[model samples]
Target: MAGPGWAPPRLDGFILTERLGSGTYATVYKAYGKKDTREVVAVKCVSKKSLNKASVENLLTEIEILKAIRHPHIVELKDFQWDNDNIYLIMEFCAGGDLSRFIRTRRILPEKVARIFLQQLASALQFLNGRNISHLDLKPQNILLSSLEKPHLKLAEALFGQPPFASKSFTELEEKIRSNRVIELPTRPQLSRNCRDLLQRLLERDPDKRISFKDFFGHPFVDLEHMPSGRSLEQATALVVEAVKKDQEGNFSAALSLYCKALDYFVPALHYEVDARRKEAIKAKVGQYVSRAEELKALVNSSNRALLQQGTCARDLLKEMARDKPRLIAALEVASMAMAKEEEGQDDGDALDLYQQSLGELLLLLAAEPTGRRRELLHAEIQTLMGRAEYLKEQIKMKETRWEAESMDKDGLSESVRSSCTLQ
Candidate 1:
């Protein structure tokens, strides 16, 4: 609500355009700078009276944070003005809208396209982490895509709030409001698969261990081997854009492969920097490890479906980790069991194989973290896996023994010789 004498500012030459959006605390408008040359921006108008002491601090903090940071992935603040009760913050606009709407219209994006989004979000996280800032809210709604369709997202329009809309039906209007139609250019192959997990980790509930840009760039998942195409980062980005078109048309596997290739190219560029910078390196390294841990934790949290479908890379990586720490191995074993159950019927052979592998990993872990009640639980679980493995092994042995017996009978050997062969 507007406080008394809260009319929007009247810059001498600047033209006040249409209203962009109105939130509980502020109203945003589209405006153009007249005397300073034609520059368009979204002006967020906040009433000082509406802000309590803490709110005032938050507003100032937002301004401070936005002004200090400059990155391709982050929204840029152009200018700010304080007049009477109204404080206006002019920011860059994003015509393509936010990610929430884009996902709604497109439904499920191809894994590759999702990967590109993941990488961009990762980049943003990396940049923020370097500055020791945390983006508390990181849902799809906060992320916007560039509208390259009309004009390449200009610096002015690629980073601001939206314009207001006429009232409409609840459901339709909700979708429209929520839908930013943000275009997610697909990632090249090597990056496509791992980027989502990365962004997800950044969005963790715990601020103590949020995914930072430095950590994301430092990750093995973002390196050269993960890219889908091109010899360089720019070229890989181009390939990702190209892959988006293919993805829109439902060519996902092709799109994913391309994204993976792009990741391969983008990762190496950051490695040397990470290796050389030791001052912040420890914090950055722990951040990466924590993010990775969160990703696996999420998979375990969501259900075994993700792990079962994503394959052994997720489990295998965890296994390598567990080899050094028995407690972690125990947790991974439990995760493997849950995932194995989900894999049942979908691919029995694969499920069984995963189960065996998980059991092997757990057995090794149990060797170290065999503490009281936990040790007993692990022992029980191990017995179950061992039983299943033994059954499978016996089945194979029985088949082999039967085949040999059949062969001997077919040869019509003497009864005594046949019996001897059969007994063995």
Candidate 2:
């Protein structure tokens, strides 16, 4: 409900173009500058009378926070104005509408499109979390679009004071919130396995256990940016070529290992690719490579079975022959990867132990190596892993310092989520 002075007005220095929309707090309009600039901005006007002390403070705090942060993924606050009756916030105009409207109108999205949005959201959240701020409410509805056909999201504040589900009573919603249970989420069928896993961590019921950006950002799903590219493509292709050579020489086990490495490079390349034709070509290569890899796996497995029948287990044979250089290299590489992944979160000391153990295995493997280009590569690999482990340690230490100073609870967060109307 508007106050008595809610009549539409042409404020000085701007021409009100049209009514955009209204919410519990304000009405948004499309407005243009007086000096003939074609660029338009959204003017959000809230009646001063409608704001209680808490609401007024909430608005001020939000404006202050937004002013300090500048991110491509967040809606920009262009300017502000205050009059006797109304407080107006001038914001960036996003013509592409919000994610909620997009989702509602289009029942399903392509997995790639969903992935793009998910990655953007992750980035926005990570940025905010890095700054020690929390959105408190993060859902599709809070995301606005800067473009529609090739959508680019600008994370906005959630619209508060609306029932999430029409069928559920307010009491039921309150009970769930009080108990820290996440409300039922809408189905996003387009999400792939890695994306879904990331979402689960983000939507964790207990805020304390909810994963930080450092943890999920590097997960296989979001880490696609680091996938093989340009110069790395040559390296990846060389690996595949060598695998084929080994297969032709009938060294099936070595071929299998090389094929796995090829896949390691190829998966990221596929993720980074944007051209439809290139992606299809990559898919074809992937299929051919996979078929060959499976054939090699079966051959390797059969050889192990033969060893087992001879009363010497393959695992025992590999362990007894510490001189088996390739076997030792493969095992250590796998173990190192597992150990580093464990250090992704603020776990208490266990991950550090794993990292040390991994480093020890790596060091022994390095010591066993005959010096050459391969040993140099191993040394570089070890240093990279060590850097990651040290970074994780620093992150845990910083998290501890911040944790001790403030409460992590977000249950009673202030009610100041944002809203923009769809109507024009």
Candidate 3:
């Protein structure tokens, strides 16, 4: 009997193999795009009738935002559709499951392994923050692994919490947040200092003082070894195409400029590329671009070469930037996160200590300032740090008292249990 539509629902070009997951609002499916490419894709289907106006608006806004963003660690939205009663989001497929499952299976990963995940998250965060978008949902469940052997993250399913596809007033959530409540993670003593520091910053409750993307990428927790550090293949290919077009038009100098930039982008592709054949292919492209640039440069007049050199060779500017230290930014980043932890009633004296250390560094920088105006600016920052430090002292005391009480309660429970066992 064909009672409740036993056959799978067809979405024209896509063949939905199996239901991947179902939540309050939307259900995801593993699909193959039956277009010219026959590409593997994930399709998120959400019934429009089930979503309220706010949810619909949020979904549209998110889709627009996702369209603008492109990074290896972030999930890609290939296509979208408004087909009849449901909205479908075509996205990249990662079969290795999400980080929550990985965590559940292995408990906590080793710091070495965990570093890769953190770096990927940081990279995704950096990308989002650059576009004035906060992930607001950066948990294990949101981070999907591609494969364990080559664990590239594809941060996904960033809907607003477990769904009834309903949008409720954030009155209760806001009140708790306003009351200096914490967003907590289990304290792992064995975690490395960098890992702990990064985790603390990421979970900082005060949005104003929370970690910034620029600072996060610089934190010691970022081990960029396994990280994908390249422009997308599409970008490099586009640049190459433009370079060739310019060369065809007999614009030697312009062609040389683009070829050089294309070659520049290709270097990182080779550096971070995992697949051997892909790496070699990129290397071949690099060679071709380099040869083209060299030939065009030779054809270019001396005046043209001299004029275009600084403008096109961004690598020169990059080298200069590498030498400059962001000391003030670094100091502020540390102090800000520490102060955030203290204000949120979280960080047990440790944040207080870090704030003091960071404060000291700022004071040192202020003392070294050569100009009066700059010195005044530095002094103002120091004053703000001092204000936070004073507040943190009271919070630290409260935290200590709380910790002691908790310790006593645990000890009392253990002693009572022992006595009961003895009597038995």
Best by TM-score: 2
How many residue pairs clash in model 1?
42
Give lDDT for model 3.
Answer: 0.59
List the candidates ranked by lDDT, beginning with the highest.
2, 3, 1
lDDT of 1 by residue, 355-387 (tens): 677776777767976466556655665675565
Per-prediction TM-score: 0.44, 0.53, 0.49
Model 2, residue pairs in steric clash: none
Error of 2 at 189 (Å): 3.4
lDDT per residue (tens digit) for residues 44-98 in model 2: 8988989999999999987888878876567788788889999888888877777
lDDT of 3 by residue, 51-75 (tens): 9999999999989987877776678
Residue 371 local lDDT, model 3: 71
Residue-pair clashes per candidate: 42, 0, 0
- So what's the TM-score on candidate 1? 0.44
RMSD of each: 22.3, 13.9, 19.7
